[model samples]
Structure formats: structure tokens, C-alpha cells
Target chain A: MLYREAGQFKTTYAADMAVFPIRQDRIALALLVAVAFIAVPFMAEAQVWPFRTDYMVRAILIPFLILSLAAVGVNILIGYCGQISLGSGAFMAIGAYSAYKFATGVHIPLAWLGTAISIPPLPGLISIPLGGLMAALVGILFGIPSLRIKGLYLAVATLAAQFFFDWVFIRVKWFVNYNSSGSVSAPDMYLGPIHINTPVERYLLCLSAVVIFATLAKNLVRGNIGRQWMAIRDMDIAAELMGIRPLYAKLSAFAVSSFIVGVAGALFAFMYLGAWEPLAFDINRSFQLLFMVIIGGLGSILGCFLGAAFILILPIMLDQIPHAVGIPVSVETVSHLVFIVTGGLICYLLIVEPRGFARLWGIAKEKLRLWPFPY
Target chain B: MVEFGQFLEILIGGLLSGVLYSLVALGFVLIFKASGVFNFAQGAMVLLAGLALVRSLDFLVARGIPMPVAILMGLMFAGLVMALTAWLIERFVLGPLVNQDGLTLFMSTIGATFILEGAAQMIFGSDVYPLPLFPTDAWFLFESAFPGGILVNKLDVWGGLIAAILVAGLALFFQRTKTGRALRAVADDHAAAQSVGIPISWIWFVVWLVAGLVALVAATVWGTKLGVQFSITFLALKALPVLIIGGFTSVPGAIVGGLIVGAGEKLAEAYLGPQIGGGIEYWFAYVLALAVLLVRPQGLFGERIIERI
Candidate 1:
């Protein structure tokens, strides 16, 4: 096959250490990028490409991006660092509502400017990190109990955070500025001259952010921090004996994870829904994100993206298939079928390959590299 | 004295509701003890069973069958389905996932929950059904010599009695029977029980089936109290706090935890609802349970676990 990488050779340490060291992989990556930028916009209409509806693109993808970011954050802690947390959604809600307050209460003219000034951004450029920082603060607080408990008990403690956050967000009117509707929403978003109200623009913004975060995550996992996290995940006492501070490693994982998830929540609210209630960030959302990380791959960044796309796209695709086939099924019927199929698939994937789609991808790559040679 | 009577009224109502909460939690504990898996789908199962009962009654009426016979038939059918569900889970899902970690099992249950919810909605339609319990017009209107008048519904008394009977029956079954002993052994240690010629898979199936039947009884009560609607599943969340309070492993613990949560929420609603713009009671039970979990992770009555690693 054209995927063979027989003659590729790394001449330098830089070349050897590159993200895509294989020549064929680099070519594939280039092709993927080219297709995404050039072909996708031309081939599919805006609606069909990202589900074609403005609300669908904005609402689903935006929240999905935020969730994916949060998943990455949780993945670092639970998957990489080996500290399980069921409260990632709580940190996300904190990030989202806090950002909403900042965006609205600051009283700036432009939406992006308002968003920027609300957080740590200077002058005009929006500071995404501020959202992460707020989430991180909450993450650390909830994560403090991890110092005492391990495994399932730790997960339950984090679950307490989830319930507490859910209760606080719904009960406290001040958080949503006493919005009588019991929901909070953000106005339109912008990045300087670029308007993010449109789906394509919003998708681009989210995609770019996902890429940046994913790259940072990938590198972090490959470096010393990743090893520390892996060490902690594999065995805490052994990791401690090996000189890794379990507390620092675990807390840092939670902080970093919460920060990513928090920013995602901001994006989810601002870019996607434009309106949401406390119910929007319920236990279901937490479960969905958790499913993404688990079914994607426990410790791989690429698995996060694959998992997100798989979970998000499958349901939408299933909902559309009934319509596409002229079955005339109601949306609810299709949704039900989607749940059945998705559930069955999850069961299948868990049984077949618990490592998730990422491991499968790795195996395929290995097979391609060794093509035509049995050994 | 009037305030004191009002408190008693609320306390009685809460205790009654707590019985139902404990029943639901008991369902969770049954499966959890027999198999190490936490059946998150317990709430959905409750809703499904309730809906099934309603649908069967409607079907029987449409077919001109007698109401009493129809109701009995429906109960029998529900028990059969629950047994089938147990078999399916043990043979296909849980069997393969036996050695998987807790998180994987958790996700699987969540997936199963979604499937069950969707299936129930598809089959039952999204309409609320009326549930009728025995002696609908009974009430105990006692003009007490106390300062405030406290009135008790006869249905509440019946509900409490029935709940107690069911709990006792379950306890007896778990304590006296050979199957119960086998289940308890599996609950204590799956490998050791299996080593002694106990069929772990069969026990798992039997326990799940028993839990399902319990769900039917709980569903009947819950449906009568709350009406059978999709939102009925939300009541299942009430059981989570119960599990936390009772400890996942204890039946009596579930009962006590349920009573506490039930009473706690009622008292919160009665006393604190007005202060917080009315409805801290909605999440009040969970808050109380969470506090308990924070203080005692193994629950009030759960045995202390000694982790090797």
C-alpha cells in the first residue's frame, strides 16, 4: 500500500524527536490538514459538514470542544496521573458561569473585549488561560480529598463535588445574575475583527484551540511530567518511593484538567449554546465526557479526539440515518435507536479493546510499517 | 406546640417517603452485594417496571380482561422480564466485563442505563399514566388534643406497613434460603465462593432478577405516589444518596439511610424551603448523604475495607 514507510530516515535529533517522525505519517497529516482547510469547505455545505444547522454547529461542537478540553484535563489526572475524578463537570460549570459573569458584568463594547477584560487578558486579546485558572482553583479544592482516599473512594469524594456544584449553580441566583429563567447565556463572541457567531468560524476557533491544547498535552505526556503522571497512575507507593510527590503530581493533574475543562465550558456557553441553564451541565454531561475518555483510550491524547468525534458523530449520524433512508421515524425514535446502537458499540469496544481506538490506530500503523515482510 | 405537631407531620411524611427510598436503595444493594458492580441503571429499571405495569393494565383493559387478573398477570410478566434482563446481563455484558476495572464497569452501566431509558420511552410512549393503589379513599383524620391538628393519610400507613413487610420478607429470604447463602458468599468473595462449587454466574443472574422484582414492587409504590412519567427516573437519584448513606453493601443500612435522607429532605423543605426561595429540599437529601460520605466513606454500617496495595 501507499502507506509503506520503507526508506524514511531521521538524520538529526530534531528529526527523530519530531511529533510525526514517520515520513508517511507526516504526509498523511499534511493531506488531512489540506483537506480540512481546502476541500471540506468546498465539498460540503456549512450545515452538512458540521450537521448544517447553525445551532447544531454552535451548540453541539462548541460544547463538545469544551467537553473535549475537559476530557483532556480529566484524562491527564485519571488516565495519566492515575487519580480518578468524577467531578470534572463541576470544575467546568465553575469555569462557564464565572466566564459568563466576567463577559457580562464587565460592560465592554465588543463581546471579545468584554470576555478578555473579564479575565486576565490584557488590553484587547482574550485570555483563555484565565478560564482554565479559575477551574484549576476549584479543581485543587475538590482534589484535596484525594490526599486521604484512593481509587473508588476518591472517585466518590469527587462525586460529592459534582453534587455540590450542581446544587450551588442551580440554587444560587447570584451566579447567573439572578436571571429569572434559572439559566445563563453569553452574547456573541469575537476575536478582534473575526466574528465567531457563525458555525464555521466557531468550529475553526475551537478546532484551533483543541489543536493547541492537544499539542501541549501530547508534549507534556512525552516529557517528564507525563512520566510522573504515569508513575503515579501505575502505582502510587512505588511512584512515591521513586521520589515523585504523589500529592503534587495528583493535584497538578487535577488543576491542569480542570483548567482545560473550565475553558471548554466557557466556549460551550459563549460560542455554542448562547443560552444554557444549570441543567445543561448536569451529571449526564459528566458521564458523556467520562465515556469519551474511557472509550477513546485511557492515556492517549489522540484517543481523546477520536473518542470525542466518535461519541459526538455517532449519535448525530444515527439520528440522521433514519431520515436519510426515508424511514419517517420521529426524532425521538431515532434518538432511542442511537442510544441502543451506541450502547452496544460501547460494550463491544470495551470487550474487544479496552485501550480504545488509539491502540487500534497504533496497531494499524505498525502493520503498515512492516508490510510485505512477515517478521 | 403547633410547630411541634407540624414537625411530626413532616417527620412522618419523610419516614414514609424514606421507606420507598430505602426500597430503591435496597435494589441497588442487592445487585451490588452479589456482584461487585454498581447498577446505575436501577433508577431506569424502576421507571421501566412502572411503565410496564401501566402498559399491561391498559392492554388487558383493551382486551376485555378482568382488572384483577390483568394486574396479577402484569406483575408476573414484569418478574419474567426482570429475570430475562438478569440473564442477559450476566451471560453477555457482565460476563465478559468480569475482570475489568471499576471505571469500565461504571461506564457500561451508564450505557445500559441509556439503553433502558430509551427502550422504555420507545415502548411506553412519553405519556404519564395514573397508578391506583388499594383503598384510595382511606384517611386518618384525627383532631389531636395537641395544639396543631395533625392529619395522617391511611394510604401512608398502608405504604409503611407494606414496605416493612417487603423488607422483612427480603431479609428472611436472604437469611434463610440456600440461594441466599450462596449469594452472600459470592458477595463476600467471588473467587472463594466459585472455588467451593458455587455457580457465580447463576447467583449473579438470580440476584439481578431478585433486584428487578424488587424494582417492580418499588415501581408500583413510586408510580402510585408520583405518577408514572419519564421524570420518575429522576427519583432514582434519591437512591444514590441512600446507597452512600447505607453503604453499598448493607440492606439494613440502605433502609436506615433512606429514612434519614427522606426525613432530612422533608425537614429541610419544611423548615428551610422558605429561607432559600423554596426547593433546597430537592437536593437536600444528596447534600446530607454527601456530608455523611465525607465524614464516613464506608457509610454508617458498612464494614471497614483493608486495601492490600
Candidate 2:
């Protein structure tokens, strides 16, 4: 069988500890990367069957990749660290608005105090990570509560951050650069001399960013810090007794998770929406990301992508299904049905398979290893 | 003097609306106490119940039924609908998900919430339905002492009165009834209660039923106040702070928490809105709850949590 590891034995410790320990997994990953990087773009350029319209790439793939990246970040905190955060939208907003501030620059004049301060604009690429760093700083600040509150209470507490940041971005005109309409547009994105304007260009940009972040996240989770997070998640007291400081583990999880999520937010605003208000990163965004982590496998890197794809594709499929079948249903009815089916599916997943699609993939892999062997 | 009266008026108004919050929070406390599931769908339940009641009332009135009889029939129909919903949720959702971690259970309830919200909209129509069960007029008090008296809404007073009656009735039920004793026993320890011949699933169904009926009462009041619509689901968001401040496990804690949240947010909005950009109430209750959580993680009335490793 293709998945059988009978002839593949790791003689070195580094080889054994590699993220993709099995040969089949590494090959599969390479094939996947090839498809994402080369084939997809080639198809989009050639205007192939599914890629005839840029809508698929622009609308679906771009948001999917961005949300998947955000889910990876959220997975680090909730799935990896065992801290439930319903305030991820707040962190995303922080990343986005801060990135916007850094990219466009800001001028704050204290006329009453007879002083003024101004920030010079940074490049778009530079500001995205800077936005992430700002989110990390705020993530650390908010994560202080996790030391005391635990479980559902902590989840509810995180909403304070969501609502607070939402208010901050909406009410404080300084953040929005005093736009009377209270909406901000993405700054011009230039990678050296190349402009990321076209849908294909934007898709590739997001894809590459996702690749780097996903790889980094995978490596992080397999490292010592990830173990610390898992330990804290599994049993904080026991982990503490074992010399893993809950403070360090929890805060670092927040920092790393928020940083990734923040970067994703910047990408989402700049690449996807192009123009957005505070409503772009509201509580529902947090829930949507959380749902991705839930439906995807909790602790698996691959699960994030799987969950994001499934959650994103579901509504589209539901929308198309009725029309495809020639059923005359109102848009409202279809939307209501979408909610019902989504809710029903979530319940079903929780009840039947709490581990989600990742577990299903795992089961398939296990089966593959024994294919053609009867025993 | 006029400012003082205005302040009292705001305070009184806040306290009364806080009573309505308590009514919603009460449903959450009931389910959490009995089944360890934080029912996020309570707001949706309120919406569904209100919709059912209002729609039924409209139907009966259109058929030439008397006003009083129509009201009675609508209440009964809504109660039946709630009871059916309780049974279905317990059978399909909560029953299978028993003994899951609190977070998983909580998330599942949210899933349930989406289903209920969608189903309610589909069945009852998504448009807002007005329930004029109570007078919406305001009463002026102490006009002799002050040039302009404090204004109090009649609806809020009715809400407070109903909440008091509901609490008293619940207390009596818990104190005097066999089923109530069984419920308390189950809340104490699930395994032990099961060992002593209590049907855990049946108890869960009953608890959900009780919570459903409570949602009905809340919907009747809230629907009358705000008009039943999709926005009622958001009341779940507002009630969360109340649950946190009051402690998740205590009924009286819910009432007190609701009062604090209502008064605190209203006071902050009125006094602080001008200085700030307004809409402070949106996060004010949550911030207060967070502060409480920091000082007393178990909340004001929640039982002390003892973790074992």
C-alpha cells in the first residue's frame, strides 16, 4: 500500500522528529503544494473550466486561504493551548486597523496641549507583520486573565475585548484616519516594483503567505513551546509541577496565535475586502474562525485548511444546490435553510465525531496503511 | 432638583429592565444547574415562544375568538410548542452529548441556537411581530416634591412584578415538590442521583421544559417591550454578563447580576456618553463582569470551584 511504512525506517533522531515523519505524508504534502502554487495559477491564467471566471479564485479561494490562516492562529490558542477565546475578532481588528495605521500613517494633534505627533507611513508588506506585532502586544495584555479564569467563564470574558476593540475602532476617528464615513481602504500594495492588483496576483500572494505561516505553525506546534501549550491545555497543574510555567505557555500561545491571526486580518482587509469598516472583523468573524477550528481537527495543522474549506464551500454548495435542482425557492428561504443545515451539521459533528474531519482523515490514512492486507 | 429626579428616573428605569434580563438569565441558570449545559439558545427560545404566542393570538383573534380566550389559547399553544422543543433538544442534542466537557457542551448549545433561530424564522416569518400584552405608558411619581416627577414605564413595573411572582413560585416548587427535590439531587451529583433511581434523561427533559416555560414568560414580556424579531436572539448576548456576575449556578444570583448590569450600563451610558462617543452600554456590562471575574472567578453567588489534578 502507498501509505505502508514497512521499508521506511528513520535512523536519525532528527528524521524521526520531522513534522512529516512518513514518506507518504511528505509526498502528499509536496503534491498539494505543487497544486496550490503551480497548477492553480496556471489554470487561472489559461481560463480552464472551473477557473474561467476570476470569481472562484478571487471570492472563494482568497477568503478561504485568509480564513484558513486565521484558523491556524486560532487553533494555536484554542486547539493547541486549550484557552477558549471568543475575542479573536478583536485581535483581527487590532491587526487590521494597526496595519492600516502603519501603512497610511497617522497624525494626532493635541491642540489643547499645543503639541502634535505624527507617524510616517510604512510599506504595505512591512505593516502587515507590524500589525501582527501590535496584535501580539494586545494579545499578551488580554491573555493575563487566563491565569485566573478558566473554561466557559474565560470564553465569555474574552467578549469584553471583542466589544471594546469594536468600540475603539468605530468611535475613535484617529484609528480610521478621520474618514467621516468611518471606513478605511487598504493602502497601495507594492512588492518591490510588482503591484498585487489582479485577482491571480492576490491569490498567489495569500497562498504564499499561508504556506509560510502554516509551515511555521506546524514547526512551532512540534517544538518545545507547543508541547508546553499542550501540557497546559491537558493539565495545567500537572504541567506546572513538571516545570512548565503556565504564565509563559499561556501568554506565548496568545502572542503566537494573535500574531498569525493578525497577519491574516491584514491580508483579509488589504487583499480581500480592499475597503472595510469595523464590522468586517466583528464577533461573527470570531465565531466563523472558531467554527473552522472545530470542524477542522482541533490540533492538526491540516485540519485548519480542511475546516476552513468545508465551512466556506458549504454555503456556496447550498446556494447552488437549490438552483441546480430547479427548485423555486426565495433567497430568504435558501438563507434560512443554510442556517438550519449548518446548525444541524455542527450538532451532528459534535454528537457523532467531536474530533471533526481531521479525525476522519486520520481514519482514512490508517485504513490506507492496511489496504489489501486482511487482518 | 430636576436633575436629581431625572437621575432617579433613569435608575428606576434601568432596574426594571434589569428585571427582564433576569427573566432571560433565569432560563440559563436553570439548565446550567440541572444539566451543566449553558443553553445559549435561551434567547432564540424566547424569540420562538414569543413568535408562537403572537402568531397564535393573531390567528385566534382573526377567527372571531374573544380577546381573553384568544390570549389564553395563545399562551397554551406557545407552552405546548416550548415543551415539544424541550423534548426534542434533550432527545437529539443534550442526551447524546452528556458528560462532554463544558466547552464542547457550550459550543453544542450554540449550534442548537442557530438551528432554533433558523427554524423559528422559517416557521413564524422573520418579520417583527408586536405583542401588546402590557401597557407601554409611563407613570409620573412625586410631582408635589419636584417640579417634574420621575417617570416610570408601566411595562417595566409589570415585568418586575411577574419576575417576583415567578421567583416565588419557583421557590415554592423547589421547596415542596418531589420533582424539585429530584432536580436538586441531580444538580448535587449526577452519578449519585442516578444511583438513587432518578431518571437522569427524564430529569433533563423536565429541567429543559421548565427553562422553556421561563423563556415563554420572558418572551411575553420582552416581545411586548421590543417586538419579537431576529434581534431578540441578541438578548442572549446581553444576558451573558448577568450570568457571569450573578454566578452561573445560582437563581438569585441571576436576578442580582441582571440588576447590576442593567443599572451599571445605563448609568455609564447616561453619565459617561457625552464625554465618550456614546454606546458605552454595549461593553459596559461585560467590562463589569470581567472585573468581577478577576476578583471572584466563581462569581458573586456561584459555588466555589475546586479543581483536582
Q: Pick the candidate with the highest lDDT.
A: 2
| True-structure lDDT of candidate 1 | 0.77
Candidate 2 per-residue lDDT, tens place, B54-103, comes to 99998999999999999999999999999999999999998898667788
Best by DockQ: 2
The TM-scores that each candidate's chain B achieves against the reference are: 0.93, 0.97
Q: Which ten residues in a row have the lowest lDDT in candidate 1 chain A?
A: A116-125
For model 1, state the Cα shift of residue B115 in Å. Answer: 2.0
TM-score of chain A of each: 0.87, 0.97
Give, for candidate 2 chain B, the lowest lDDT window spanning 10 residues: B300-309
Query: In model 1, what is the error at residue A173, expressed in angstroms?
Result: 2.2
TM-score of candidate 2 on Cα atoms, chains taken together: 0.98
Model 1: lDDT of residue A41:
46
Summarize candidate 1's per-residue lDDT along A1-375 as a digit string, tens digits. 677756787789998888877787788878976765555444434446445556554556565666677788778887798777777778778877877766556433467655533333231115345666788898998787777666655666677678778888888787887788888767556687666655667777777777778778888888887899899888778988999987888788888888888888777776676788877777777777877887788898878877887888887787777788887888778777776776776777777887788899999877876776758
lDDT of each: 0.77, 0.91
- DockQ of candidates 1 onward, in order? 0.42, 0.69
